[model samples]
Target: MDAASVPAPASPGPATAPPGDLAIWFFILAELLAFGVFFAAYAFARAHNVALFDTMQQTLDRQAGALNTVLLISGSACVARAVEAVGRARSATGARWLLAGIACGAGFLVVKGVEYAAKFEAGINLSTNTFYMFYLSLTFFHFMHVILGMVILVALWVKTRQGAYGPADMNGIESGAAYWHMVDLVWIVLFPLVYVMR
Candidate 1:
């Protein structure tokens, strides 16, 4: 066969696979549904006790929440950059960007820990009041998700260093970055709902 007459096979990638593992979308959807229910409950509770929600909301550290918001946003952007680098087969650059993203996620955890510590020191617990119940419960739930996302990111970073991803092959990295973006998106909704909304 003439070289010019030979047809090239289609390269399966994000455009074909929806970015990442097909299975992860199930997990992401389940997680999102859970968060949606929680958010609905929060709205219900707030509706029933507007004054209490508003008062307790004030006790929360808006500054810390805001800081975490910025970190997650930045982290998500870095993950995107990392994905792009990986697509280009720039393993070193991709790994570096992933590390930066992981750092941002870790920073969020630290800021959240301090905020929780202060709450605990003040003797605030789920039983403290209704508003506190939702405040702590919701944030803690999202906090756990952040931790899980970081774990995923670290694995992706390691894989990137090993030359496991590229434009022709990126399911693993795409899936991990997708999950991390979900984590960030939830927080974007959460911060406004729990802190900024009255």
Candidate 2:
């Protein structure tokens, strides 16, 4: 064949970038740093009041904390599935997964709310001691993140149901999923530190 008639070898596709927007990753890093500082404060406080922390830890609703753990972890898994589905252009399936993830996050909030109610009923407050202070502040901080994460998931679900996300346009859903995973991760660490640690 004439060289001019032969096709050139196919060029490889462009390299894949990270799943989400660069801005979202930077936001995630900042959020993680804030959580890290909070965690370190908890650890430092606990070290100086080991006996008090241990005693107070015993009074916590271990079952409730454990349940919230399950709920958050399940939520994270559902979000992951949602992202995967969206990447495959299966918007309906992605919406379903996002809804499931939202439900899981809501369950966590409900369980944690009940736990807080009980604590307040028993007159527990930040003034209760160093332990309750850290427990309430740390967990509540995480609680707000969960709420924000759920909000992001809800938005993603709405857009996904409208066929907004797909392989060609994944930045929004991926960014929201990244933040939701961060919320789940902080809870995983908080549960052990504030609920079960000695």
Model 2, residue 8: what's the lDDT? 64
Runs of candidate 2 with Cα error greater than 4 angstroms are 1-17
For model 2, the local distance difference test gives 0.92
- Residues 83-191, candidate 1: write the lDDT tens digits: 9999998989999999999999999999999999999999999999999999999999999999999999999999899998998888899999999999999999999
Best by TM-score: 1
Residue pairs clashing, model 1: none
Model 2: per-residue lDDT, tens digit, 50-125?
9988988999999999999999999999999999998898999999999999999999999999999999999999
Model-by-model lDDT, in order? 0.94, 0.92
